[model samples]
Target: MSKKFFEERGDQSAVKAEIIQKYFATWANIILPTAQRYGGGKIAYIDLYAGPGRYKDGAASTPLLVLQKAIENPSLSGALVALFNDMDVNNTQTLQSEIDALLGIEKLKYKPEVNCNAVDHDAEEYFATTKLIPSFTFLDPFGYKGLSLRLVNGVIKDWGCDCVFFFNYNRISLGISNPMVQSHMAALFGDDRAAELRKNVEGVKPALREQMILEELTQALTEMGGKFVLPFRFRNDKGRLTHHLVFVSKSFKGYATMKGIMASASSKADQGVASFAYSPADSSMPLLFELTRPLDDLEGLLKKEYAGRTVSMLDIYESHSVGRPYLSKNYKDVLKKLEDAGDVSVVDPDGKPRRSNSFADRLMVSFPKVKK
Candidate 1:
């Protein structure tokens, strides 16, 4: 971890913090209400590469923001286990000092634990035997020394657990072809898949190479029971793709929650749809014409899936929205458009018309039957 990164907080850094903060807040709220079903009335927030709590410019980082959120909520204060770890001893020491200075730290049942330890030390050794306490783990390792798929699977193996990691694509992409970093690549994508990934990306264009690597990694995670893996790309000032903030979880709700958060922080939106990326030069680019359309295609999907049947917007969204960029609002907007074209009717549960109003989650959308 470089101390210079904390010297001045950049835009991407700030966006990362905001995404974590917003997701953790929503995650805590959803978990606390139904905590008993998940585990033994406990939850955790783990930060493996926690840096100094505050930047030199006086902006707070994820470690501090998490503690502040814990302080604000009484339920979280009582049940949350805050775990901060760093490979660098200096970073952990500064984080401890910052935690101590946080107001009302003693009100929590479990005090925040700060440790200076190797993140991947015996990671997979005890992963299967030892069950974690339903944690949300954030791995922001410097470079790619300690990152491994096994470590990520360990963190998200337990019930109600999720993970968001910083993936340095630029470094990994460059290193994929190097024999010196073969062992490291194997640790990340597993030995067999890693070899395949390297072979597949060879002699390909830069864009296609990137896609191949991401697809290989996604397939690896999918085999480990991680169904929903979302990546938010970050591009440098020169329009070069840098890295991604990838969120992985087995739960659909967690996927949807993080998707909403990331969508808002995106640098550009095509019409009302978010690109789910941040680019330095994106805002300066002018929108000339429509290259793509909205969820009219979604209307076709809905009609094909539920012809002559009626379903609630919530059900429609939950059942079909996974693995797609379409948001809940996109469903509503598309449904409204369908109603106007007489393809579907939006109504309340009691069969009352809601066509003149906003289409809510609970509102029913009835699709008309098509002739054979």
Candidate 2:
């Protein structure tokens, strides 16, 4: 196998890195504390393909950022295990040096009792042998080959483990036709069924074909027992699709936490599919502009499903929250609007019309009856 190359390159930070860092930081901030609060004393973070701790420009990489988050949060000062794995020896050494520097500092506040392990091993082999734990694994590979579907299934088969991976859409699409990598592609999708499906879409439009492949991969994850799968698309400076940050988790809470974080990072207010773009013009700044999708679209969807049906608030939120672009907060807002406009009736447990708009307290929602 080819040695990891990104760290060997002089320039470390790129537009794509900027976009990814924002989402990674957001996710860590939410998940770290939440995991500590509920995980009964132990929490873990595993970064497969962790790079050198900092970019040439001094921007902290994912490993350092995660460590910093743990250090900042006093509540998570319990047993926290952080495993940083990379196949490249230089990358692992660099990360360890950075950690050593942090340890040498005397005055850092809220230092979590971190059991840090830096390993120089292939991510696939590590996952195959390591005993699974309640952890958050970040699988950001340069390409699609190292992260197999079987490994991902094994990681998430138990509870309290969530995965965020870089799905290289451009690379995968370009390589799909190459015969040498066909075995890897088959392993990625967990079977030959997806390969057959891809073969059938030979002449489809480029955009549509990419979407189909994304759907197939996502389906494969869900079939491996993932309760929620979310994909956040990233575009490069020239408006070309780069990679998708795909998240998989068995918990609805994990799904909601990630969805909320992604929504907050988004610049759009429509609360439907969120996308982030990196532009050459704003190289130094965070690019989190929301693409405009009609709010009416969500309203229409809600109406179609909930109209004339009595659905509980939790059920409604759970059903529409994860895997979709919109947030549960947005869904609640739309339901409140429908209630106010006399289109849907929001009720309490006693079946009386709810006086407040809070859906958490409300028991059920009944759409307005159609006039004869």
Candidate 3:
């Protein structure tokens, strides 16, 4: 058995589990409402490198938790589709059995299928054929080689899905830093791009090399016609960093929700009441969120978006099709000011449309209270 496989099955530290749970929760909150409202569209939940349903320490594995959550959450009312893949036949069989046993416990309105195969190959084919339009794929590879950018982007375009990817930066950087193992990076990224990456790495440290790899990955995603939230890192027990990056949509609203989710998670960790921190930047300050500035920038983006649109804030939310908690009071002020400035219009409580002559951004915009 591979050493890394054993480590994953063993008790993943609290931090690791917390990050996984938070990632799951974030998607559940963000994507489920749409699936529920869309009148039963297929919503896929894929595990690219799925392990057995239980950890060696007896905790529920991420794949199982996702399945359970989707089945239980009212928001996940649409088709609860899932695909679990593993390279090892034995592990795959064990996973399949576990899934089947869990399914047998209760009659599920939706049934999920599990397969044993190489995920990178299977993911593309599955995305192509599956009925799931807006999907959620979890690519928790033990290393970077499990899937390639081409495959991932293809799936994203084909399915229009969101993903939470666990990138193994430590292993990838180490693999490339040693001139001896550099050839493997070619297989990981691709032959042409690997050569390009090699040319750029003259004097990069192992850790910074990992950071560069993430930047490159983000750039590739951007070039493929997607905007991404900045990748964040989480550390293991020994203080080694793992690149458990979560990527959401290009929508400023999506970015805003993810920022709020990440911020709340870090706050929970800082209070010593939760498991996921913001990053592994500094051990002394590990709980601090490294992406706060970018989140604030995202708020600024929302401000600009609200400023330019002639629609009311409630109408804006309707257009984006989300109602998360990040839409703050200040955002309301932006809309109110837009209304007061004659830029936008609102419907008041008495079913009368109000158009303000003023142009300030302090007005709170909302849908009129529905009549009883």
Candidate 4:
């Protein structure tokens, strides 16, 4: 019924902090390196649905996180044009107070401007003025309908900026299921597309509906000339999924870094183990899942990745377009299975034998051998 902060007050706000910090840090890492490789330029952080500067939970909110990154990276010497929009006057007032408090304590080198307007009304014009040619925007709107694909196109093509939107999949699933939300859906997916989506998505429950939203969003991003990573899932204390996704693009190297953060986040949760029972809901669904493979699994994936030529571990990752966590999960097991069959040999980074590798050498070991 209500939104919950992922962490308690005075805590590091692990969820908020990890996402916000990693988002900016990834951008900084990518953009700074890019500047060195090509040339120097400007970058910015645009928060479309910017909330009150500080959360009630004492977390360094998105604005503060972005500001902190700007301060830390002097090499990235860029202006932080923070375009914050909140329709609520109370929220705007609180945000102003928080900003003043932050400024009083520590002066920021980069100037951040805040606005008190709705995102739908002001995003285009606000972004138009700022020279955010190489900017990374965070569209953390509270609702799915608040942002339209047309606006997404405008931000990327017209503004020449890449974005990481927080898709509130649960809200979309719930909203579209309600007939009252047709108009809102039309704003986002057009009349015909909305009808199609509704037709195909009617019987689906909330959980499955969330997955649909992700696949559609990814497809739409691709159609808009953006390549995106799969939706990364986060679990609450109850192990129930929290309904949000972080989308990255090919134009934005931050995607790779964020992908690593995502992998690390999931790894810390259970150490790269994701066991599940196949549910009836999984049939014919377009839900995007894990973004990376872990290390141990990566060994086997590398063998599959480079069956023909000698390759490095990092090279295998790039070839198959998988991440570290995927390697750790499925690929490591793949190597073990192969070694048992006497078909492939496992080697270290220096090309030294790590184990006496064997695979189906005598025609006795089957590809999918039954376990005794």
Candidate number of the best lDDT = 1
Clashes of each: 0, 2, 8, 25
Tell me the tens digit of each residue's lDDT in model 1 across 12-127: 99999999999998988887767756566788999988988989998889999988998888888888999888877888899999999989888878989998878665755555
Q: Write the number of the candidate with greater lDDT, choosing between 1 and 2.
A: 1
lDDT, candidate 3, 1-372, per-residue tens: 432454444323344455556665666566666666764555667777787677666566777777776667655634566778777877777777777776432544566676677665566666655555566666777666656665566556632466667667767766655667655565456566666777676587766766567666666667664565445456654456665565645555555555555545452232112233343344455544333433344344554555533444555543442322233433454445544665445554445445554322233443322234
Ranking by lDDT: 1, 2, 3, 4
Candidate 4, 39-157: lDDT as tens digits: 44556666766677665667657776667666666654354455566666766677667776763224454566677776663565545444445566677766765677656655655
Specify the highest-TM-score model's number. 1
What lDDT score belongs to each candidate, Candidate 1 first? 0.84, 0.65, 0.56, 0.55
TM-score of each: 0.90, 0.80, 0.66, 0.70
Off by over 4 Å in 3: 1-40, 74-78, 103-105, 120-131, 158-160, 177-193, 205-208, 236-240, 248-250, 267-372
Q: Candidate 2: where are CA atoms >4 Å away?
A: 1-40, 103-130, 271-273, 276-293, 350-363, 369-372
N/CA/C clash count, model 3: 8
For model 2, how does the per-residue alpha-carbon lDDT over 1-372 read when each residue is reduced to its tens digit? 223334332321343344344544555555566556775556677776777777656667767766765566554434456777776677677777787687422333323222324322344566657766577777777787667787776677665777888888887877677677777677778557557756856888977887788888888889878778987666655445667777788888778777766655543344454543223423443343433554567778878767678988778888865556766666777878887798887667775654565666356888755555
Off by over 4 Å in 1: 36-39, 287-290, 300-312, 345-349, 352-355, 362-372
